[model samples]
Target: MISLTPLKMLVLLFSCVLSGALGGYYAASFSPVPAQIAIVDVQALVKKAVEKNQAQTEDDAKALMTKVKSSTEELIQRGVVILDAQSVLTAPEEAYVNIE
Candidate 1:
């Protein structure tokens, strides 16, 4: 077995520590970012759409629901937490975004 000098041992230890630190940094960089909280005024959106089209048919309602569902799903997939405007008593202005 080869005997390791003190200097050699120190260098090896330093390399190991450096590699571990770099690996951890890279891992952290690649990790997904935390989700953001967003507020959506579902009632307002529906109201606006309904107002635009005075004659609301069943098909139109179904289409609107489908659009909302798909949009919510997309936001959820991107790690966003959506809160209904009515449900949230208070939220930061920055948290509010147009879902349309």
Candidate 2:
């Protein structure tokens, strides 16, 4: 028959704790490597996006201004108006249509 003395139990516990800590250290040392990261120039990417947006906005604004100018010129060519039945009757057909 075997009996465990307090001293033997303490030694066993200490050995278990020491071996567990050592095993954990070794496991961490051989852990899987991290995935590769793709490098990007964030400043350049932002600048390009901003420039593209500005160019698109400018193009849209120019087209709108051109359309507005042509419409205004057409209105001017039609003739000036004072509140009268003749002005209403003679107004351009385009003036009556609902523009999108």
List ranges where model 2 is wrong by over 4 Å. Answer: 33-40, 47-51, 54-100
Clashes of each: 0, 0
Each model's lDDT: 0.83, 0.52
Candidate 2 lDDT, tens digit per residue, 1-100?
A: 7888999999999999999999999999999854222122333433555676765566665665455445445444655222322334354443332211
* Candidate maximizing TM-score: 1
- Model 2 misses residue 12 by how many Å? 0.4
TM-score of 1: 0.55
Could you give the C-alpha RMSD of every candidate to the true structure, in order shown? 6.1, 28.0
For model 1, the stretches where C-alpha displacement exceeds 4 angstroms are: 1-35
CA shift of 63, model 2, Å: 26
Error of 2 at 15 (Å): 0.7
Model 2 worst lDDT run, 10 consecutive residues: 34-43
lDDT of 1 by residue, 17-92 (tens): 9999999999999999644877778788889988898888889878877777677786778888888889999987
